[model samples]
Target: MNVLINEQYDIYHVAHSGVPLLRDVKQLNPDVIIIDIESPNRDMLENLNKISQFAPKPIVVFSEQQCANTTINQMVRSGVSAYVVGEVNQKRVKSIIDIAIARFDLFQTLKQELAETKQKLSSQKSIDKAKRWLMETKQLSEIDAYHFIRKVAMDNSQKMDDVAKNILSVASIF
Candidate 1:
């Protein structure tokens, strides 16, 4: 394994156990992580999950033990980029690492997009609620309320959502 990896990439810290996985990862800040294990235990998976949540990186696991489908699913959900069972082929190691990196990149992009979308949706909901409040209390039309909010946002150079939030807060005082 070392021979195959050393040929193409520089080796970082190597752990004989998974106990200090997260700490090592945080300290090393490696671009990619490769784990060679006989089998993944519950603790190892938990550590991997923590790494995924705290410090994300592409992870490739080469294991001699065959894992169940559920275990594989758990690994993927825990942010493992690649999991290979049985003996490692020297020729395929580089390609495996490349694929893991690509997969990790794609997943991160999708995750970021989803978060942005959620934030936009939340802001839209707040704006809509504020508009409804203006329509009901101020006796303004929907278009008028929207324009009022937009004008206020433009004047103050603030986001429309922020203006809407302020409107709601003022409304709540009444």
Candidate 2:
């Protein structure tokens, strides 16, 4: 694996024995990671998960042991972009690395989109709550309340959700 990788990419760091994996990965910040193991263990999976959460990178694993579907799922959840259960073929190494990088890129895009969608939903909820409060306190219609909030937000160069939260906080005081 080292020889094959060295031909294509520069080896940033190699772990021979008793090396801290996560800390090294965070510091070096490699473009991708490849691991050869006899079998995937719980500790390895946990470390991979932590790496995924902190400093995400495309990971490819080559294992001699045939694992169950559950194990494969766990590996994917732990951020293994590519998992091969057989003898490592030199011919396939390049393709495998390419596919792993592509998968990782797609996963990151989807994750970001999901986070933005959740934020939008939360902001809408806050805006709705503030509009309801305005209707009750100021005797304004829903559309008028929305316009008022929008005007305030535009005037102050702030987000509507932020204005809504401020209104809610003031309402809570009374």
Best by TM-score: 1
Candidate lDDT values, in order: 0.61, 0.62
In candidate 1, position 72 carries an lDDT of 44
Give the residue spans of candidate 2 off by over 4 A: 1-87
Clashing pairs in 1: none
Candidate 1, after superposition: displacement of residue 20 in Å? 12
lDDT of prediction 1: 0.61
Model 1 weakest 10-residue run by lDDT: 55-64
Estimate the overall C-alpha local distance difference test score of candidate 2.
Answer: 0.62
**Candidate 2's residue-wise lDDT over 7-108, tens digit each?**
445555674333365566556654444443322432453366564654332223333243345544544553544432224453465465544444554666
Query: Each model's TM-score?
Result: 0.54, 0.53
In angstroms, give how far residue 34 of model 2 lies from its true place: 4.4
